[model samples]
Target chain A: MPDTVATGPGPAPSGTALRELTFGEAIREALAEEMRRDPRVVLLGEDVAEAGTPFKVVKGLVEEFGKDRVVDTPISEAGFTGLAVGAAMTGLRPIVDIMFGDFLALIMDQVVNQAAKIHYMSGGKWKVPMVIRATMGATRRSAAQHSQSLHAWPSHVPGLKVAIPSTPYDAKGLLKAAIRDDNPIVFFEDKISYAKVKGPVPDEDYVIPLGVADIKREGRDITLVATSSMVQVALGAAAMLEEIGINAEVVDPRTTWPLDEKTLIESVRKTSRCIVVDEGYYRYGITGEIASVIAEGAFYDLDGPVRRIGARHVPVPFSPPLEDATVPTERDLFTMARQMCNK
Target chain B: MATAPNPATTGVEAGTPLRMYRQMIAIRLFEERVNDLYTRALMPGLAHLYIGEEAVAVGICEALRADDYITSTHRGHGHCLAKGAAPHLMFAELLGKEAGYCKGKGGSMHIADPATGNLGANAIVGGGAALATGAAYASKVLGQGRVAVCFFGEGALGQGVLYESMNLAQLWKLPVIYACENNLYNEYTHYSETTAGDPVARPAAFGLPAETVDGQDVRAVHAAASRMVERARRGDGPGFLLLNTYRFRGHHVGDIAREYYRPKHEEQHWMAERDPVALHAAWLVSEGLADQAMLDRIEKEVAAEMDAAVEFAQNAPYPDPQRVDEDVYA
Candidate 1:
C-alpha cells in the first residue's frame, strides 16, 4: 500500500487547516462550531461549565459561550433529561451529557417514554430537536455501573436516531449533523477511544449525516461489521487476519438506527461471509441485530452462517482480569473472521 | 396582570365574581357531561373529572394573562377550560376525533394547546414541572414578560424531578409559579402515604417562597396566585402554592370502589360542607353578586353549551389511520 493509493474514505480534508485532533477536542470543536452557528444551541449537564465534564469532552466551552449557555446541572438525570426535552420544545437546542452511559436508566422514562414518543404521540404538533451525549465502553475500570455500553437500548427505540462515532473525524462531522437534526438523538461517545483515537479532521465546517455508515477498510474475503470502539478492534483483527492471506472488509454503522443497510448488504454480498462486533453484550445486543438483518436481507449471498463477537452476558466486573474476560478481544474477532474464511 | 391589590381584585377580562362564577359553572357542567359520555361509551378512555377541584384551576387561571403559559396534570379539564380551550375541541379529543386540540392523538391525560399557552397535561406524575420551568426560562430569554404556572398534585412531591425543577427555578429566578392541588388522595392511596415533609416548606428548602391556601375558597386562592404571578413577572423569582382541596367523585369514572381507601365519612364531609363549586356559589349569592335566578340561568346556559360540545364530538370524524406514524420523527 502506498500514499498514492488513497488510504482514507471520502475526500482529503478540503482545507489548508487540516490537523490531527484528539476525539474529545474534535467533539469540543463540533459543539463550538454549532453554538457559533446557532445561538439557540446550549450545553447542559452535570459539571459541564466549571469542570468541563468528567471526560473533558466539552472543555473550554464555557469560555466561548457564556455561563448561561454552557450550564452545569444538578445530579438529576431524570429531572434534567426531562428539562432538556422541555427546553427543546420551547426553543432551545439543548445538548445534555449523561456523564456515564449506565445512568441513562435514571432518565429512561423521560428519554424513552417522553422524548422518543412526544413527537409521534402529539401527532407532529411538536418537534424535540435535542442531542443527548453519553460516555460509553468498558476499558478504564470505572466498574459495572459506569463502564457498560447501552447502545442497544436506544437502537431499539423508534423515534430516536443513535450515533456512535469511532474516530475523531467522524465524531466532529457526525456530532454537527446530530446537533442540527430536528429529531431527538442519542449520541454515544466511546470513553476508551476519546483520547486514544485521532485522525486528520478539517478546520472547515461540515456534517456527516445520521443513518450513514463509513467503510474504514476495504477488503473482499469477509465482511466485518463493527460499532463504536469496537471499530478499532475490527481493524486490528483485519490486520491480523491479513497475515494468513485473509482480507476482511470493515464497516462502521456510525448511526445505529436508520442503518446504512445498503453498504452492509453490498459488502456482505461481495464477501459471501460476515461477522458483527459490538461493545454491548452478545445477547439481545447490537451484534445480534446486525447479524439478523444481514441474514434476512442478504441470505442468498452468504457462504456460511453470519457470526457475531461481543461482550459476554454478565455485569462488567470490578477486577481487571474479570472485566477483561467479559469483553471480546481483537484475537476473539480474529478467530471468528478466520473461521468465516476457513483460513 | 397583578390582581393582588385586593382579595377580590378584578381580572383583565374575566376577573369579577360573576364571571368567575360563570366559569366555575361551565367547568362543573362540562365534567358532568364528560362523565355521562364516558359512561355511555360515546367517549373512550378514563376522564379524570375536575369535579371537586374547580376553584384551584379557576382561581389560579383568573390571575394569568392570555399570553402566560401553564403546564397541567392528568386531572386537567378544569385547567384547560379555565385557560380558554374550547370545550367542543376538548370533547373532540376525548372522542378521538380529528377536530381535537391534539387532533385526537393526545387524549384526556395528554391534551395540550400551545396556541393558548396550555403546555399539555402530563400522564406521568410530576412530568410537567420541568416543561413549565423551561417555558419560564424561554419567557425570560425572549424578554416577553410572560409567566408560567405549573399545576401538580401532592403526589408529585414524591417524584425527584419536582425538587430538581424547583431548585433550578429559584436558582435562576425564572418567571414561574408552582401550584400544588393537594386533593387529599392520590388515586386510591392517601397523599400522606406517599409524600414526605411539610408540603409548603418543601419549595422553601430550595429558597423559593411557598404558601398554603384554602383551595375551596376561590377568593383566597385567587389572591395568593395573583401575588405569585405578579412576583414572577417582575423577575423576583418563583413561588409555590399548596392549595388544600378534595375530589368529590372517584379518581376516574371507573374508580367507584372506594371502600378500601378513605372512610365514607370523609367523602361526605367534603361533599356535604366544603364543595368548592357550592362554596363559591354561596359566596357569590351572599355577596349579592348573583341571585338564585341569575345562578340558575348561568347553569342552564352552561348545560346547553355542554350539550352542543357532546353533539359536536359525536359528529366529528376519527383521524385517518395513515397519519398515525407520521410524526414519530421530524
Candidate 2:
C-alpha cells in the first residue's frame, strides 16, 4: 500500500523519468530545502559549514544560507551533540553531524542521556527537535574506527527514532521527515551507498513518513529484509537468486526504530521464508530483531526457517579481503537465501 | 562603547538589595532544607548542594531580567532559587510529587523552570555549556537581546564540549556568558588535579573578554555580571566569567566522608572563614545597606518560606504509577 516502487528492474520507473540524485546529494538537498522552509533550522559539526564535511554533503549550504545558519564546529563530538540538545530544547532545529557512526561512543552521553532522555525526563514538557546525522557502514576501507554500522545503538533507546535510508529517494524523504520530527532522531547515511546509490528523487518537497517499509522487489519465494545500504545488497542477491529460479523479494525498512513490521509480516506471510541481511555485526544485532519479528508474527506461515545474514562479530579490518569477509555482502545474502530456499 | 550601569544607583531601587538579599537567603536555606530532607531519608537519590556558591547565582541573576536564560549544573538549587523558581514546586520535584515543576519526573539534578528562563540543570559535567550556546544563538538569530548565562564548575572545563561550545559562542558573537563556578573540586578529585593552564585563559583562548570574579562577594559578581550582560545585550559578544568559589558540603548529599579526599580542616576553613552567606551578611551590616535586625528579618522570612515549601511538598501527591509508561515519545 506504500507509494514506494514495488518491483525494481534497476532504473526504469515505467513511463515517467524522474529527476535523479545520488544518496549524498539527496541528503544535501534535504538539508537546504528544510533550512529554506524553517528559519530555526541550523547545521553544525566539524567542517560541516566551511568544508562541507568529508563527504561534501553540506557543500554550498553556508554560501546560500550564510555562516550563522550553517555552523562549523570544532572537533568535539560530545560538545556539539550537547549543543544540539540545548539548541533544540530552547528554540532551534539543529542537524548535528557526528562524522562517523563509530564516533557515536564519544557523544553517547549527549546523544543517549541528554538529547534522547530530556523529553521523557521533562515529563513531555520539552520536545528535543534535533537530528543527529552520522555516516555508517563499511566497504570503503576506512578501517576499524571509521567504518561501522551502529544504528542498533540509538534504535535500542526510547525517546529516539533511527532512520537508515538506502536509496536517494528514501534518503531525501527520511532525512526531511527526521528534520521535521519533534522528537530526537538519528539519521544514519550509508557511507558506501552515498555516491554509489542513485535514484529518481523528485525536486518537489516530500517527506516519507518514518516507520514505513518499502518493498523494492516483488516476489513469491522468499522475503529479504534489508536496511540502509543493505537494501542494495539484498536487491543484488535477489537478482542472483532469479538466475537460479528462486524469486526473492527485498524490503527496505527506512526507519529502524519504528520498523514497519506490518509490511515485513505481510511479505513473510506471503513468501513463507525470510532472511534479514545487515552490514552490522550479527550477535544480538538488527538481523536478529528482524528475524524474531517474522518468527513471532508469521510463525505458521513460514515453510522455511527465518534465516539471518550479518557481518561477523569483530572490528572491521583494513584489508579489502578481510573487510569483505567481515561485512556480509550480496554473495552472503545469496547463500542465506539459497539455504532458505533449500537450493 | 556603552557605559555599564552602576549597580547600586541604577538597577537598585529602594528594595532591590533587600530583595536580592532575600533571594540569596532563600537559595541558601532551600539547599540546607534539601540537605536535611535527604539526610532524613525523605528524599530519594542524590542532590548536588549549592551551599558556598550562592553569590554567583544571586549576583548574576540579579543583573538580568526574567527573560534572560541560565543553564545550571548538578549543584543547581541556588541557581533555580535566584532565577525565581518556586521553592514549594522545587521541593515537590525533589520529592517526586506530581505537583513538581517536572511533574515528579526530573529530580534535583534535572529541575528546570522554563517559564523563569532556567533552561535546565545538567547532570553531565559540561552538558549545559553547548545548551547555553544554542540558547544564546537562538537569541542572536531571533534578534532578541536576551542573554543566556551558563553556570558550570571547574571540572566542566576539562570537558572538550565546553571548549567547542565556547569557540562557537565567540565565533557567532552569541549573547551567552560562561559563568564558571570554580568550587575547587570535580567529584572527589581536586580541580588542580584535572585542570590545565588557566580556567580564565581557556575562554580567553577564544578571544572572549574573560575575567575571574570573587564568588564570595555578591556585589562584585553583580557588578561584573552587569557589565557582561550589558555588552551581550548591545550585540558586543559573549563574555566568559570564572567565579572563584568553594562548596561547604560534599559533591552530593550523601558524600559526607570528607576526610578521605580533602582535609576536614580545608572545608572548615571555607565554611567558617570564606562562607559567602556570612561574608554577605557582614558586608550588609558594615556597608550600612542593612543592619543586623534587617538581615535577621530577611533570614526569618526565608526560613518561613522554606517551611511552607517543605510542608507543601510533604502534602503533595505522588504521580500515578500507571503514568510511568507515558511521556516517553512526545
Candidate 3:
C-alpha cells in the first residue's frame, strides 16, 4: 500500500500520497467546493436534498446552499434533464444526479435529442453548461437493471462530453471542471469506487481540465489503458506484473468522449505493446474505439496485436459470483498483460 | 354569421399592424416555398409544414419582445420566421447546407436562431414544455422580466413532461406560457383518440389559469397571447392557452399518401373553408384596411424574397468533412 495521508490540518507536504475516502465523500467535496466558488452553480436530483442524496455525494449541499440551489426533484429524468439543459442554456450551471445510470435509457430523448444537440443545433448561440452525475457498477445485488455501465451510449453522441472518475482526487477536480464547463457533460461514478477508493483532494477550489489523461504508474515494457473503476484494477494488475519482470505503464483517461488520444498513442508508441481494460461489454465498447485509434494512428510502433480486456457480452447477473465473473477483474488484466509481454 | 368586434376599435390598439402583417405574410410564404421545395426534391428530409398554422406563430410572436424566449415544435418554420430567423438560413437548413442553423447537422426538424431569441425547434414531442419552464425559472432567478413561450401540440398533453413542467411552473411561479396548438391530430391518430380529457383541463388541474382561443383567427390568438404574456411579465406564474386549429396538410410533406387516417372531406373542409391566411386576407380587405392590388404586391414581393432564399440555399457550401468533430464541446 502507498503512504496514506489525512486530508485535514497537518504538515501536508505533498509529493505522492494515497488517501482513503469513499467515492461518495470525494463527489460531495467536489460539489461543495464548486458551489462555494461559483454562485451560478446549483444541484438537482431525486433525493439529493434532505434525503442526503441517493449516493450521499450531495449530503450537506441542501443545508449549505438551501433548497433553492440544492433541489430535490420528482422522479422525472426527462423533465428535470430538459429543465437542467434550459437552465444551463440561460447561464445557470446545473449539476443533475440520476440515481442509477440505467435510468439514462429512459431519458435518452432529453440527453441525446435535446441537451446534446442544443449548442450545435442553435448554431453556437447557446451552450448547455450542465453535468449529469450517476452511479454505475454492480453492487448490493441491485440486479440487471441498476448495475449496468451504459456510458457508451452517451459517448456515441456528439456535443456531449463524458467523464468517469475513479479516485477521490479525480472526483473533486473533474466535478469542479464539469460544473464550470460551458458544454454539456455526463459524469459517471462507479458504485464500487464510491466506498473502495480514496485519495488526497485539495480543500481549495481546483479543476482538472477535460481531455487529459493521468499516468497511474510509469513503466516501459507495456502500456495499460483503463478508465473509471477499471483504472484501479489496472493499477492492481500492474503491481502484480512488476514481480514477473514485465513493467506496465497504466493510463486512466478521466474523460471518455473527447478522449486523450495523444497521451494514449504516445505511451503506446514507446512501449510497443498495449492492453485496454474496461468494464463495459467487448463489442462496440470504449476498448474497441481505443484499439482502432491506436491501430490506425500508431500502426508502425506496434510490435503485436493490441489486446483488449472487458466484460463479456452478457447481462449483469444478480448473483455476486456471476456478476464478479461478468466484469473484468484485476486478474484478467494481469493475464492479458502477461500474454502480450510474452509475445 | 356574426361578425367579431374589430380589435382596433377595442381601445387595446393592436400592435404595429404593418409589422404583424409582414410577419404573417413572411410565415405564409416561407411555408409555401418549403412545401414547393419539398415537392421539387430540392429540400432533404421530412418537413412538417406550418402552412395553415401561420396565425398561431404570428400572433404569439407579436406578443413577445426581441429579448423574450420561445420553444418551438417540429412544425417550426413559421415560429422561426415569426421570431425573426433569416429566411435564407432557414432555407439553407432545409436544403442541408453549411449555411443552415445547425450547419446542416439538423435539418427541418431542428432549426434554431438564438440571436432572435428563438430556442432550437425540438424534434421530440412535448420536449420544449419543460425547457421553457426552466428558462422561465432562470428569468426569475436573474430578475430579467422576460417570459418564455412553449409551442407544443394537443398530442403533447399525453407527455408526462408537460404535466411536470406545468406543476413546477405554477409551484415556483415561473414566467412561462404553455401554448398548445391543438390541431386535433398527433400524426395519423386524432388528438381525441390519444388525449383522455380536455387539453385545457390538464393544465388547469395543475392550478394554472387556462383559456381556449380561436387559433384560426390571428386577432383572437394575438389578444389571448397578449393577456397571457402580460400576466407572465407581471410575475403571475404560468398560463396555458389551447388554440383550436387544424393542419391543412398531412403531418409531413410525404405524409399525403397516409390519407387513409382522415377523410378527404375533412382535409378539404379545413383547407378550403377554414384557411387561416385566406380568412385573414378577407378580413383585412373587407375591413378597408388593405386593397386587392396591395395584397397582390405583397404576395409578389414575398415570392421574390423566397426565391432569393432558395437560390442562396442551393449555392451554400457543404460543411468540411475534416471538421466534423468540431463544436462537440465549447
Candidate 4:
C-alpha cells in the first residue's frame, strides 16, 4: 500500500528540514541528505564543485562530501550523463545537473533512449537509479539557447520520472525522493525560483513521494493546476479570484510523469472548472497533456470547458518586455479563471 | 602500460577444445540462417549480420560465465547465441514473436534475455558501452564476481559517450571489459575515411590499458578476453581490447552491393581467407577434438532449431494495444 501520510499530510517530520530556504538551498539540502544516508550516492555536473553549481544549488557539497563524491566533469552533457547512467547501473545513485535545461538536447540519446528504456528493454534485470537536475525558465534574459522549460520533452519519454518543483518545500522533498527512486528521474528547477521562493522545510530527511499533487489552496469555484514557476502565478491568480468571490483551488503536481491525476480530477469535480498554467509554449505542450487527460477521464464531471494558459507559440525572446509577453502571467491565469467561473 | 603482446600467445590454453568449436559453428550457422530469413522477408525490422566476425563474439563469450553480463551492438545475434541465448528464442525474436525475449516489442536490433545475463542489444551506435560499464559496477556492488563485456564496432570509438564511459570505468576501477570489434567499416564508409587516427590510441590516451588483437583467431580472442575479464573481476579496473576483424556483409540486410565502396578483390580476400569460424573449426579438427561429420551434425541441429523458432514466431500473437502503456513505469 502507498504511504498514507504522503497523500494525507500536514508535513513529513522524519526528513531533513530547511527553514526559509531559497530554492537553491533546498536542493542542496536534499542532495546532502541523500548522500549522507546512502554511501552509494554521488553528485556530478560541470561546475558542481567548489565553484558551486551554475545556480549555486550544489554550494558547499564538495567541501562536505569531498571531491570523489561531488564530481565536477568536463563540459560534455552527453558524455557525463552517460557516465552517470553507468555509475547508477553499477550501484551508485548519481544526482547529475545539466546546468541549463536547454542543453538536454545534447544528450537526448543518453536520457531518452538509454536511461529511460534500459530497465524494460533489459526485462527488469537492471534499474538506473539516477537524478538529473536542470534549471529551466527564462530568467535574466538567458534567451533561447540558455533558458527553456523543457520538462515536456522528458515527460514524453517513457521510463523516466519527471519532476518540476515550484517551491523550497517541494524542491527539497522532490529532490530527495528522486535521489532514492529506483527509476531515472529528471528534476527541472525553474531559474526564476532559485532565490525567490522560500518556505518551511523540516530539518530531518524525508521524501515527498512522486505522483502526488499538493493542493496549495482549497476552494470550490475552479481548480488551477500549475507546475514550477507557473505554480506561483496560479496562486497569485487564485488570491485575486477570492476577492471577486471565485474561490479557486490551486494544485501543484510536483512530479509531472507519474502524475497525481486522481487529486486533480477530484479538485476539478468539486470546482466544475479547471485552468492549467504552463511556462512552455502552448501547442503540444505539457498543458495540452494535462488537459487531454482530464478531458478523457473526467469530462462528464466538468461544468465548464478546461482552459490552458501557457507561453505563446514563439521562441523565448531576449528583450525583457517580449520575454515577459511570451510566458504566461498572473493576468492570463486570472482572466482564464474568471472566464471559467463566469461560464 | 605493459607492452602489447600477441593475442594468440597471451590467452590460449594448450589446445583448442571441441566445445569452443561447437560455439563458433553455432554462431556462424545461426547468423547465416538469420541472414537468409531476413532476405526471405520472414524476419521483421533490419538485421545486421555478424557473418564474417564470428571469432570476436565466440572468443570473448567463451571467456565469460553464464552469469556474467554482455551488452551487444545491433549486429548482436552472434553475441546472443555465443552468450547462451536459446537459438529458438533468438530466431523467434527476429521473427517478432511472443516467445522471443522482450516479447516481440524488441525485434532484431533489440533482443535481450537477462536470465542468461545478455543485457539486450542497442540499435544506437556506441550506446551500450556505458550500460555495460554500469552492469559491471552493479556486479561489484552486489558482491557478484561477475564481469561485463561491451561489444561495439570501430565506429563507436569516435562517440564521446564511449570516451566518457571509459574514463569512469578506469577511474572507479569498475569490472568492465570493453571489446572493440574493429571491423574496418562503418556502413559503406571505410575507417580510414571517418576515423582521424588509430582507435586503440584513444583509449590508451584516457589511461586505460589497451591492446590490439587479431579478431579472426578464436583462440587469440578467448585468451585476451579471459585475461581482461580476470583483471576486472579482481578489481584491477577496465581493459580495452581492440579486435582487428572484418564484416563481410553490408552494414545491414538489404544493403546494395558496395563494390563502389571497396575493391572487389579485397572483399574476396576477407571472405575466403579470414573466415573465423572455418579457421577455428579446422584447428579443432586438426588437433583431434572433432571431425567433419561432427561439424555437419552441429550445423543440421542448429538449422532445425532455427526452423522451429520461425514456426513459433509465425504462430505467436501480437501484444494487445492496451498493454502499450504497461511496463513504462517501474
Candidate 5:
C-alpha cells in the first residue's frame, strides 16, 4: 500500500491531528492558497466572484483576492475558455470554471484542439499551464444536461492531464498540483460529493502528485479500483464486504490520465481478481481502459476475468428513482463483488 | 464608413512610405515564391496566398508596436512578414524543415513567433478572435499596455465566437482591434451570399467603434489602424476596421479554375485596376517619391531575397524521424 493516511471514515493516523473539511471547503482552500502563492493564478467563471457558484465552494475568494483575480464571466463557455487558453499561453495561469462537465461539449475545440495542443503544436514553445475545473457525477435531479462524468474526453487526448478527486484531502492536494503543473489539466469534481463527502485535511499546503493512487482500505481477497465519485461507492462496498469475511481493497487512481498504472497493476497482482469502477459510461469508458490495463499487466496473476462497473449507457434521467438507477451504487458493487468471489 | 481612394500626399515621414512600399513588395514576392513551390510539388501542402491583400496587412501591422500581439488567419504570410518574421524561417516552416517556426510542427497556416508577438496563424476560421481578445484581457489585467489585433477574413462574420469575443472585449474595455479583411469571398462562395446584414453593424451593435476604409490605399489603412491602435492603447475599447479589398488569386494554390464561382472579367478588372501594389507604385512615382528605376531596384532586391530564402528552405534538413514524439507536452 502507498504510504498515506487511512481514508473512508477511518481514524486519524497516530501522532498527527488532521482537520476535518468538507470537499467544497477543501477545493476552496486549495484555490485560495495557490492564488495567494502565485499572483498569475486567476479564477473566472459565471458567478464565481460573488455567487461563489451554485455550490458556494468559492464563497469568500473574491473578498480575499479581489475581483481582478476572481473574475465573473458571462455565460459564454467557448469564448471565455478560448480566452483562458490564450491567457494561459501568454502570461496568466488561468483556472477556467466550466460549471458542469456536460458543458465541456461546448468548449471541446478550445480544450481539445487549442489548450491541449498549444504546447506540442507550437513545438513546445508555448505552454498552457491552465486548469479547467468542471463538475461530474449523476443523481443530482438536474437531468442529463447538468450531470456527466466526461473526464474520459480529456483523458483521451494526448497533451491533457485528467484529475478526478475522491475526497476532501485528494481534492485539495490534487487541485493544487493541477494548478502548478505545466500542462493543461482537466479537474473533475464530483458534484454530488462536494457537500456530502467530508474527510481529514492538513492545515498546511500539500500537493498530492498526479498519477498517484491512494489505497483507501487494503485487503487481499479482491481489488476495487475506483475513480472520482465511485471511490466512495467502492469504500462503502468494502465496508459491506468486511461484514461477510470478503476483504476488498479500495484503490482510488485520483487521476485518470498520467494514471498510476503501477499501483493498479500491483494491487491486481496481489489480489488476483479486480473490478474497475467509474462514473463515466459503461461502454468504451474509463472502466474498460483500467480493466484492460489490469488484464495486460497481471494477465498470469488473475484467477478470472477483470470485471467493470460504471454508469448505465443512458442519459441521466430527471426523476429521482430513474436517476438513482442510472448510476452504479454501493449495493450494486457489493453484490457484484460477492458473485465474482463466489461468496 | 469612409473611403479614401488615393494615397495621402501629406502627414507621413519621407522614409515611412518607402518602407511600406518595400514591405508590400516583400509580401508579393513571398507569395509568388509560395505559388512557385506549390506548382513544382516541392511544398508538401498548399498555402492561401496573401497576394492582393498585402496593403491591408502592411498598413495595419505598420501601426502596431514590436511588442503588440497579432493573431492571423490561414492567409497569414503577409501578417507574419509585416510583423517582422524572417523570410527564410517562414519558407522553412512552409516546407516543414526543422529550422522553421514551430520547429516545423505548424506549417504555413500556423507560423507563430513570440519574439515578434505573433500569437500564431489559426487554420480554423474565426478561431483566433477570442485568443487575441484574451491577450488583450491579459494586457489589461497585467497592465502590459499592449494592444492585440485580430486578423480574420470577412467569412469569420458568420462565426458566433467572434461576436462573443467582441462583446467581452468591449465590456471590459480590452485593448483589441478586430481587423476584418473583406476579401469578398469565403472559400468558393462570395461572402455576400453567406453574410447577412452589414458587417460593421455587428461590432457596432456591441458598442465597438467600427469603421470601413479603402483597403486598396495603404495610407488610408495605415492612418485608420494607427488611430484605432492608439485609442486602444490609451484604455479605449476595441475597434473594428473593415478592409474592403479583393482576392487577386484563388482562395488557395489548388483553387486555380475560377470559372465556377468568379468570372474572368471580374478577376481581370481587379487585377488591372484595383491592384494595391500597382496603385501604390503608380502613386509613389507620380508623387516623385521614387522613379521607375528605384521601384524596379526594390523589386529586384526583394526577388533576390525570396530566391535565397526559398533555396535555404529547399536545402534545409527535415526533422529526425525519432523526434516525432517530442514537444507533446511542456
Candidate 6:
C-alpha cells in the first residue's frame, strides 16, 4: 500500500522515480504476477495465447505460462463464458477474455443469469471468482460493430462488479485486485489507451481496491468526474482551464458498480460545481447514474445543475473526422467546465 | 459411433437391478405426490413431472459416483432424487420452506445440492450444457478425474449454445456426457417437426461417440451410460447418449388439456405398454429378482415415504422475509 502512492497516476511527490510501463505492459505484469502467485488462475480467449490479442497486451504470456495456463479458445463467447462460470464455481479461478466490449450482448445470459446469480441461486453454497477482461473505446476506424463502450450493460446488473482503469498504474493494481476478488468482475480496458498511455508502476505487487476514487488533480473552481479514457481528456481540459484562471479538479471513479460516491460528492461539495464524463452513450448511461448520485448526495452544496458529457448517441462511424466527433474530447470538457464556472 | 451395448454386459450387480426398480418407483410416487400438491393448490409454482422418464435419470445417475457432477433440467425432481437429494427438503422447497436445498431460494426447477454433485437444475432449455462442459474442463485441468453428465430434453437441441458447448467439449476432449432424453415431443409438438436431420449424426459430426438407447429400459440406459461414464473417467473425451422415450404426463401439471396436441389413445398406449416402472418391475419378477409380494412391499414403502415427505413439507415453515437478500453476494 505504501508503494501505491509512488506508482499511482501523476508524478511522485517524493522518493526515487519508478520505472515507467505502458498500459499494456502494466496489465501483462499484473496477470503474470497473479498467475505466478496462484495456480488456480487460468486465462482463456480467442488468440489470447499465441496471437496475444489484436492489441498485443498479453503477447508473451503464453510463452511464460505455457499454452495450458494461457488457453486459446474458439470464438464461442457464450460457451466459454459459461464454462468460466462453472470452472469458478468448482475450483479454478478463470479469467475470461472477451475480445471486444461490444460482444457482451452474446454472453449476457451466461454472465448475468448464470455467473452473476449462481451464488444466490445456490443459497450461498457456490461462489464465482472469475474476471471478464474486455476492451472498450473506439476511433481506430473499426466502425460501429467493434467500437462501442458497453460498460454500462454490466454496471446495471446486480451481482457483477465493473472496473474501468484509466492509467497504467491503476490498470496494474486494479486488475490485480479484480483477479483476486471473490465475485464476478467485468474489467474494461480502453483499447486506444493501451499503447499511448504511460505511467509509473512499482516492481513489487500492489492492488488498488475496486470502488475507490483517485483525484488526478486538485482545484477549487469545479470538479470533473471521469472514467477510463475520459480521465486523460478531463486532465487536458483541467490544464487548459488553469491557464484561463478557473481551476478544475479531476476525479476518476475507477469502478462503476462499486462507485466511490463519497469522494465524488465530497469533491463536488468542496467545488460547488460538477461535470461527469464517460465514454459510453450520453442517454441512460454511466454518466447519468453518477451525476444523479452527486446531485442527491451534494444537492445543497451545488452552485448549478450537475452536467454530464459522454459519447454521442450515434454509432461510431468509420470515417476519422466523424468518428472523432462522436466521442468526448478535451475541448468538449473545457467548454462545459468554462460554462459551469461562468469564466 | 457405436450402438447400445448388451445390458447383461453392463457389469451391474445382482442387487443393482432391484435397487434401480425401487428408484424408478420412488420417482413415480414422488411425482404423484407433486401432482396432488399442485391439484390441492399447496405448491406455489409450475411442476414438470419426470413420471415416464424415470428410467433415464435413475439409470444415468446410478452409473455416477457421489463425487462426479451432474447438471439437470427443468423436470429435475427425478434427477435430484436419484442423485441423493433428501425428499423431505425437496418437498419443502416446492412449498417454499426454509428447510429446502437452496433454503427455498431455488424451487423445484433449480434444486442444487453440492454434497451429491447436483450442480443445479436449469429452467432454461439448454442453459446447463456449458456449465457441465466447464466443470469437465476444470476436472481435466485440475487432474481431478471427475466426470460431468448433462441431462436435457430433445427441446434443447434447438438451442445454439448446446452445439457451441458440444463443439468445445469435443475439441478439448472434456470428460462430459450429453444425455439427451428425446421423449418424442418438444413441449407439445413432435421433435420431427422441429429437429432436422438425424439427431445421432449431430454429435458424430463433432467426433463424439454418439449412441441411442430406449430410455424406458433402465437396464439398457444403465448399460450405455456406464460405458460412457467409464470412458469419460478414463479421460477418453465426451460422449453423447440419445434417450428415446415418451412423456406420459402433460408438459407441466397445469397442462392437463393435452388433447389438443396429443390424442388419448397415444397416452394410454404409452402408459400401458411402455411404462418404465412397470416394465422393470415385470423384468425383476420374471428374473426372480423379486416376487409379487416383494414388489408390493416396495411400492407400499415408497408410498408411505412420499406421504410423510409431503406432510413434512406442508408443516414446515416458510423462509423468513429478512433473509431474502442474504445470499445475493458471497
The C-alpha TM-scores of every prediction are: 0.94, 0.92, 0.90, 0.87, 0.95, 0.95
- The digit string of per-residue lDDT tens for model 1 on A1-343 reads 1211111434455546667777788899999999999999988899999799978888899998989899888888887788788778778888999999999889888888778877766667777899999989996887899988998998899999999998888988999999999988999998867777767787688899898899899999999999988888888899999999999999999998879998898899999999999999899999888998899888999999999888889999889998999888889999988877778
What DockQ do the predictions score, one after another? 0.59, 0.59, 0.56, 0.40, 0.68, 0.69
Classified by CAPRI criteria, candidate 4 counts as acceptable
Kindly report which residue pairs in candidate 3 clash with one another. A21-A198, A23-A194
lDDT of 6 by residue, B1-330 (tens): 111221321232322887787778888999999999998998998999999999999899888887788899899999988887778889998888898888898899999988888889998899899999999999999999989999999999999889989999999999999999998889999899999999989999899998899999999999999999999989899999999888989999999898888899999999999999999999988999889988888788778888888999989989999999888767
State the C-alpha lDDT per candidate. Answer: 0.85, 0.85, 0.82, 0.80, 0.89, 0.89
What lDDT tens digits, residue by residue, belong to model 3 across residues A38-127?
888888888899987666667878899999899888878877888888878886888889989999987788899889988877657678
Give the better candidate number (2 or 6) by lDDT.
6
- The alpha-carbon lDDT assigned to residue B310 of candidate 1 equals 85
Worst 10 residues of 6 chain A by lDDT: A1-10
Candidate 2 deviant stretches above 4 angstroms: A1-17, B1-15
Model 5 spans > 4 angstroms off: A1-16, B1-15
> How do the residues A1-343 of candidate 4 rate in per-residue lDDT, one tens digit apiece?
1111011122656454435677777888888888889989888789989989767878899989998788887776887787678668657888888999999998899999989997776545567899999888984697878878889999999899999988788888888889889999999998878777766777766688998889988888888999988887887888888889889898988888999989888888888888898887788898999998777767998986788988888888899998888888888888877877773
Q: What is the DockQ of candidate 5?
A: 0.68
**B330 Cα displacement, candidate 2 (Å):** 2.7
lDDT of 3 by residue, B1-330 (tens): 101112221221326544456567777878888889889987778889888888898888888887788899999888888777788988898888888888887788888766777777988899898888888888887889989999998878888888888888888889999999988889899877888867777888989999899898888898899999999999999999989888888899888775678888888899898877788888888988777876767667777888888899989998888867666667
Worst 10 residues of 1 chain A by lDDT: A1-10
Model 6: per-residue Cα lDDT over A171-190, one tens digit each:
99999999999899999999
Worst 10 residues of 6 chain B by lDDT: B1-10
lDDT of 5 by residue, A124-206 (tens): 78888999999998987999899888888999999999999988999999999999998999999998778888888877777
List A-chain TM-scores for all predictions. 0.96, 0.95, 0.93, 0.94, 0.96, 0.96
lDDT of 1 by residue, B1-330 (tens): 422122121332368777677677778999998899889887788888988889899899889987788888889999988887888989999899989888888899888876678888888899888888877887776678889899998888888888889988888889989999999888899988887778888887899998899998888998999999999999998999999999888889888879799889999999999987888889888988778887887787777778888899899999998888777788
Greater-lDDT candidate between 1 and 4: 1
Q: Arrange candidates by TM-score, highest first: which order?
A: 5, 6, 1, 2, 3, 4
| Native-referenced Cα lDDT, model 1 | 0.85
Better of 3 and 5 by TM-score: 5
Q: Considering summed lDDT, which 10 consecutive residues are worst modelled in model 2 chain A?
A: A1-10
lDDT of each residue in B92-162, candidate 2, tens digit only = 99999999988888898898877788888888888888888888887888787889999998988888888
